[model samples]
Target chain A: MEDIWKGLMHAGALLFGGDPGVWEIIGLSLRVSGLAVVLATAVGVPLGYVLGSRKFRGRTFIQVIVNTGMGLPPVVAGLIVYMFLSRSGPIAAFATDVLNWWDPAAAPHDAPRLLFTVGAMLVAQVIISCPLVIGVTAAAVGSVPLEMRLQARSLGATSWHEALLTITEARRGVMAAIVAGFGGIISEVGAVMLVGGNIEHSTRVMTTAIVLETQKGNFDVALALGIILIGMAFVINNGLTALQQSGSRYER
Target chain B: MSADARAGKSEPIIVAENLTVRYRKRTVLDVERFELYEGETHAVLGPSGSGKSTLLRVLGLLEKPATGRIWIDGAQAGSADREARLMMAAVFQNPYLFKGTVAENVAYGLKLRGVSAREREDRVDAALARVGLEGTQRHSALQLSGGEAQRVALARALVLEPRILLLDEPLSYLDPLIKRKLVADFSEILTTSGVSAIYVTHDQDEAMVVADRVSIMHEGRFVRSGTVDDVMGLPTDPWVADFIGMETALDGEIVDTEEGIARIMVGGQIIYACSMFCPGQKVLVGIRPEDVMLFAAQSEVPVSSARNRLTMRVEAIEPRGALVRVALRRDGLRLASSISRASLRDLDLEPGDDVTVLFKATAVHVAAAQGVPSRL
Candidate 1:
C-alpha cells in the first residue's frame, strides 16, 4: 500500500514535471498506436462496409475469418509480422529492394533489418488492431437497417451517396470501432515488446518500459508508467465517449 | 389555362406495360398495362400479399421487374436512371426517418440534390407547414409519436417536390384515431398539391375516400380498374365482389330473363337480378350488406316494392359500430344484412330468429361462371 502511494506520487510528478525520458516514451507509444489505428481504420472501415452491406457468395466464410481474426492473440500476430519481415521472408526482400533505391546508404547491406524496429512494432500493432476495427465497424454498418439505404436511394442518393449517409448514421459505432482499435493496440505489450525489441530512446514505449522497469525491481517507475498508460487510455476514451454520446442523443 | 388544365395537357406521368415481377418461382406482380395520368391519385387496392405493394415498388422504380418497359414523363426509364428515380418519392408503411432533427430529416433530400441552404430551409419549412407540423422543425425525429413520425416522413418526401409520390400503406401503422385524422389531412394535401400519386393499400374505405380512380388487384393481376364508383359498385368478377365486402354471393343458374331482369335459380329459390344474362347461363349473384334490409317476419312485408323478399333464419348477429351485422341462412343460401342497431333492437332480432330479408333486384350484381369459382 505504501509503495503504491509513493508510486502514484512519482507518477504524477513525472507527468507534470516535464520529464524528458518519460515524455519520450509516452510520445513513442502514442505515435506507434496512433499510426497503426489510423491505417487500420483506413483499410478496415471500407472493407467492413462492403462486407456488411453486400451479399455475395463466400461472405459468411469471410465473416467467419474476420470474426476469428478479431480475437487473434497478440503474440501470434507479433510472431507472424516478425517472420514476414525477417531476412529470409518474402516481404523483407521486396522492402529491401525498394529501400535500396530510395536510400542506398541507409539500407542494410547483408540482410533485411526491419526486425526490432519501430516500423516492425507498427506493423504488428496494425495487424493486432485491424481485425477488431473491421469486426466492430461491420457490425455497426450492418445494424443500420436496409430500409434507410433504400429511403436514401429513393431520395436520389447514388450508391456512393447512400454509403456516405449510412456511415454518417452509424457514426457512433464507427467511432467506437476506432477507439477500440486504439485501445487494443495501446494496451498491447506482447506484440510491441517482441517486435520493438524495447530499445531505449529508439523503440521503447510506456508499456514496454513498465515491463523492463518491473523486471529490474524499479517498482516505483514501473507503477508510474502503468499509471501514465491508464491515464492516456482514459483521456482518449473519454473524448471518444463524449463524441459517441452526443451522436446518440437523436438515435432511435 | 389553370394549372390543372395545363397538367391535363401534359403527357401521362407514368406508363408501364408487360410489367412482371417474380420472387423465386412465384410471380408477385404481373400487370399487363397500367397508366397514371398527371394530377391524379390512383389507388391500387388489394388484400395483403395481393401484389399491390410489389406493383407500387416497381412503379416507384425502387424494384426492377422481371420484364417491363416504363416510361416516365415520356422518357424510357431503365433501372439505373437516376433522373427518372429522382422524379418520384415513396413513403413506406413504417415511418423510416433517419436519425436527426425533424428539420434535418426533411432537408436531407434537398441537401442531396445540392439545393442552396436558404432554399432547403424554405422548402423544409413549407413542407412541414403543409403536413400540419409547422413548429416541429427542431424536434428530434426519434422522439415523435407514430403519427408525428409519419408526418415527418411525408414532409421529407414533399420537400423534394417530386413529380409523383408513391405511398405503400402509409396509414396502416397508425392508430385508428390518428389514421382518421391523417386521412383527412392527406386528402387535403393531395388535392392542394395536385401531385400525381399511386396510393397502395388494403383498406377499401381508404381507397374509396382518397382515390379518384381505384384498381382492384388479385392474384398478381388487376381484376378491375375504373372510377371508384365503377369499380366498387360494379365489380366484374366474383372475387372482386367478395373482396369489396359484398355480403352475399350465390351460385345460380339463369332460369328466365325479360327486359334486362334475369330470374335466377339459387338453392331452389327464384331471385330476380337487374342484369342481362342469357337463360340457362351459370352466374354468381352478389348483394352488398348495406343493400339488404331486414324486417320482422310476422310484420307486413314493406309497402314499397322490393323484388326479392325471403324468410331467413338468423344464424349469427354481431355488433359492428353503430350497426348490427345479421348473418342469415335459408336452405344453405347465406346472406348478411347490416342494419342500424335501433332497427335491430326494434325488431328484437337475435341469433336463431326468423327474419325477412329484402333487397331490390338492381342490388344483385351478376358475373359469369368461369371467374366466379375462384372466389368460392
Candidate 2:
C-alpha cells in the first residue's frame, strides 16, 4: 500500500516532466486512443446517420445487432485479431518478410509488422468501441424532430441533401458519441493485450501495461497506470455527457 | 404557365377527378370532382373533422389520394414526381417555422433548388417584402408572432414560385382586424402575381369573402361546389343553404298551394310562401336572416311577392358589429334576421314592440331533406 502511494506520487511528479519515458507513454496512450476514436467516428457516424434516417426491411435487426455489439468483450476482439496475424494464422505469412522500414539495425532479426503493433492495438480497440459509437450516434440523429424533416422536404431537399443536413447539424452529438467510445475502449483490457502483445518498447498501451505490471507483482506502477486510466475514463465520460446534453438543448 | 400549359390553355390548373382518400380501415375523404383554376382563390370550407385539412393535404401532394388522378397545369401529376413537387407548395394553418433566422427559413427552398447564393438572398428579401415582412430578414424565426409566422409561411411558399399555393386555414387564429388585413393583402398579391391558391378554412365568412369558387365539405364529401355567389345565394342543398347563413328555418304545412301562389299556416297566422309544394304537405322553409326586413308601425306589405310576410313583435335586438340580429315572433313562429344597425335604428326596434316582417318569396327557399332537424 505504501509503495503504491509512493509510486502514485512519483507518477504525479513524472507527469510534470521528470522522466522522458513517462511522457512517451502518455503521448503513445493519447496517440493510440485518438487515432482509434477518429477512425471509428469517420466510419461510424455516417453509418449511424443512415441507420437512423433510412427505412428498410430488417432495420430493427441491424439495430439489434449494433446494440448487442456495443457490449462486446474487448479481449475477445484482441483474440480474433491475434489469430488473424499469428504465425499459424491466415495472414501471418505476409508479416514473415516484414520490410525493414523503421530500423535497419534490427532488420536481420524478426521484422516488426503492423500485426502485434500499435496500429493493430488501435484497430482492436476501435472494433470493441465502434458499436457503442454507432448506437449513440444513431440515437442522436433519430432524435431530430419530424417537423424539421417535413420542413426540409417541403423546402425541396432530396434524400442526399437531407442526410447531409442531418449530419452537419448533428456534428456535436456525433463527437460526443466518439468521445464516449474512446472512454469505452481506453479502459478495455482484452483486445489490446491480444493484438498489441504488450511488448515493453514497441507496443505497450496503458491498459496492457497496467495488466502486465500487476501480473508481475509490480503493484506501484500498476496502481499508478490504473489511476491514470480511471481518471481519463472519468473525464471522457463526463465531457461526453455534457456535450450530449447541450446538443439536446440546441436540437429542441 | 409553361409551354405545356399554354398549349392546353383551356385546361384547369388543378383537377382532382373522383378523389378519395382512405386510411387503414376508414374512408377519410371522397370528392367527386374538384377543380381549381389559374389565378383564382378556391376555399375548402368545413368545420373541424369535416375533412377540410385532408382535402388540402391531398391537393398539396403531402398526402396521396387512395384513388384519384391529380392534374396540374395540364400535366398528369401522379406520373411526374419532380413536377408535382415543384408545382405546388402548402402553408399549414400553424406555420411551423424552422429554428433559424427568417431569411434562412425563407431561402431554404430556393437553396435546395440550387439557386445562386446572391439570387437566393435577393429572392428571400423580395419575398419577405411581398409578405409585408420587409426588413425582418435577420430576425429570429422563433421570436415571430402567430400572424407573423403565418406571413412567413406565405413568404416561404411564395419564394418557391410554385404555380399553385395551398394554405390550410392560413389565417385561422388571427384577430379579426389582422384576419381582414391578411385576407386583403393575400388576395391583392395573389391577383397581381397570378398565382392560383387553394385556401382551406372552417370560417364560411372567410370562404365567402375570398373564394372565387367555394366547396362546402361535410363528412369528407363536398355537399356543394360552385362560384361563391352561386353556392351562398342559391344553394341547391338544404345543408348548404343553412351553412350559408340562412338562419330562419321554419317547418309548416302548405295550404292553398296552387300555381303562382302558396299559403303556409303555422300555429295561428297564415303565411304565404313562393314555392311549388302542394297544399297539405310539409316543406322546409329557409330564408337568410338578412333577407327578412323588420319594420315598425305595421304596414300591409305586398301580399304575395315573397309569399311569407307576417306581423311579428320584436323580441330582441342584439347589436352586432355593423349589423343587428333582430329576433322576432309572430303567431308562434320565432325567427332571427340580420339587419343593418342603421335599419334597426331607423325602425327604432325594441323588445316586445310589434313589427311587421316582410319575407320576399324570392328570398325564401323550400326543400325536402330526410331527418331534417326541427330546430335547424
Candidate 3:
C-alpha cells in the first residue's frame, strides 16, 4: 500500500509536470489509434449499412463472417498484419517496390521497412477494430424501421437520399459503433506491441511504455501511464455517451 | 392538342392494368384493372390482410407488382422512377417521423427537392396550419401525441404538394374522438386541396364519410366498386352486403312476382321485395338493420304501410353506441335489428319474448344467388 501510494504520487507528478517522453508516448498512442478508428469507421459504416439493408445471395454468409471477425483475437490480427507486411509476404512488395517508386526518399535503398513502424501498428489496430465497427453499425442500420425507408422513398427521396436519411436516423448507433471501435483499439496492447515492435522513443505507445517501464522496475511511471490511458478513454467515452443520450431523445 | 396533353387531361391520374403482387408464391394482390381519376378520393375498404394496403403500395410506387403496367399522370412509370414517385406522397397507419422538430420533418421533402431554407420554412408553416397544427412547427415530432404526430405526418406530405396522396389507414391508430375530429379535418383538406388520393381503411363508416368512390376488396380482389352510395346501398354480392354492415342477408326463394314486386318465402314466411324476379328463383334478400322496426307481440297491430311482419323470439340484445342490436331468431333464421336503446326499453322485451319485426317492402334488396353458397 505504501509503495502504491508513492507510485501514485510519482505518476501524478509525471502527468502534471509535462514529461515530454510520457506525453510523446501518449500522443503517439492517440495518433495511431485515432487514425485507425477513423479509417475503419469511414470504410466500415457504409459497408455495414449496405450489408444490413440489402438482400442478396451470400448476405447471411457475409454477416456470419463479420460476426466471427468481431470476436477475432487481437494477437491473431497482429500476426496476420505482421506476416503481410514482412519481407517474404505478398503485400511486402508494395512497401518494397511500389512505395519506393511512389516516394524514394521515404523508402531509401529501395527497402520500405514497415514492420516496426507506426503505419504497421495502425494497420494492426484497424484490423482489430474494423470488425467491431462493422458489426455494431450493421446492427444499428438494421434497427432503423423499414417504414422509414419507404416513407422517404414515397417523399421523392432517391436511393442515395433514402440511404442518407436512414443513416441520419441511425446516427446514435453509428456513433456508438465508432466509439466502440476507438475504445477497442485505444486500450489494446497485444496488437500494437506485436506489430509496432515497441521501439524506444519511436514506436512505444502508452500501453507498450507501461509494459516496458514495469519490466524495468519503473513502477511509478508505469502506474502514471496506466492512469493517463484510463483517463483518456473515460474522457472520450463520456463525450460519446453524452452524444448518444442526446440522440436518444429523438428516438420515439 | 398533342397526344400527351390530351392524355394528361382526359386519362385518369393513375391506371393499373393486370397488376398482380405475389409474396412467397402466394398472391397478395390481383387487381385486373383499376383507375383513379384526378382530384378524387378513392377508398379501398377491406379487412386486415385483404390486400387493400398492398394495392395502395403498388399504386403509391412503393411496391412493384409482379406483372403490371402503371400509368402515373398519363406516363408509364418504371419501378424506380424518381419522377413518377415525386408525383405522389403517402401517409402510413403509424406516423413515422424522423428525428427532428415538426417543422424539419415537414420540410424534409422540400429540402430533398433543393428548396431554399426560407421557402421551406414558409411552406412548412403553411402546411402545419393546413393540418390545424400551426404552432407545433418547433415541437419535437417524436414527442407528439398520436393525433398530433399523424397531423405532422400529413403536414409533411402536404408541403410537397404532390399530384396524388396515398393514405393507408392513417386515422386507424387514433382514439374515437380524435379520429372524428381528424376525419372532419381530412374531409375539408381533401376537398380544398383537390389532390387525387387513394385512401385505404377497414371501416365502412370511414369509407362512406371520406370517399367519393369506394372499392370493397376481399381476398386480393375487388368485390364491388362504385360511388359511395352505390356500393353501400346496392352491394351486388352478399359478401359485400355483409362486409359493409349496412344490411342483414337472408336466403329466400321467390314464390310469386306481380306488378314489379317479388314475393319471397323465407323460413315459412312470405316477405315482400320491391324488385322484379322470376318465380322459383333462389335469391339473397338484404334488409338494413335500421329498417327493421320491432314491437311487442301483444301490442295491437300498428296501422301503417309496412308490408312485411314476422314474429321473432328475442335471443340477445347488445348495446352498440347510441343504439341497441337486438338479435331475433325465428325458426333458426336469425336477424339483427338495430334500434334506439330507449325504444328497446319501451318495448320491455327480454330473452325468449316474442316480438314482431316489421319492415317496408322496398327495404328488402334482392340479388340473384348465383355465387352465394347455400350455407352463407
Between candidates 1 and 3, the one scoring higher on lDDT is 1
| Clash counts for all predictions | 0, 5, 0
RMSD of each: 4.9, 8.3, 5.4
Strongest candidate by DockQ: 3
- Residue A237 displacement in candidate 3 (angstroms): 1.2
Off by over 4 Å in 2: A1-12, A18-43, A54-56, A70-130, A167-176, A194-197, A201-203, A213-252, B1-10, B49-54, B173-181, B232-376
lDDT of 3 by residue, B134-160 (tens): 798778889999999999999899899
**Model 1, span A1-252: residue lDDT tens:** 988998999998998998999999999999999999999999999988888888889999999999888899999999998888888898878877787888888766556688889999999999988889998889999999987887888888888998898888888888988998898899999988888899999999988999999999988999999998888888999999998888778866
Deviating ranges (above 4 Å) for candidate 1: A96-112, B1-12, B17-33, B217-226, B234-242, B247-286, B300-324, B327-335, B340-354, B358-376
The DockQ figures for the candidates are: 0.69, 0.24, 0.70
* Index of the highest-lDDT prediction: 1
In order, the interface RMSDs are 1.3, 3.2, 1.3
Return the candidate ranking by DockQ, descending.
3, 1, 2
CA lDDT of each prediction against the hidden true structure:
0.87, 0.75, 0.86
| lDDT by residue for model 2 (B1-376), tens | 3323432454478988888888777888999898887777788988788888888777766666889988778777762265576777778777877656889889878887889999999999899999999999988787888889889988998999988888788898888899999988877877788778898998877786677778889889998876665456555565765555554356667777666467776656676656676666766555567888766765555545555657788777777668888877876676678899778778887898888788776676565433643212
Docking class of 2: acceptable
Best by TM-score: 3
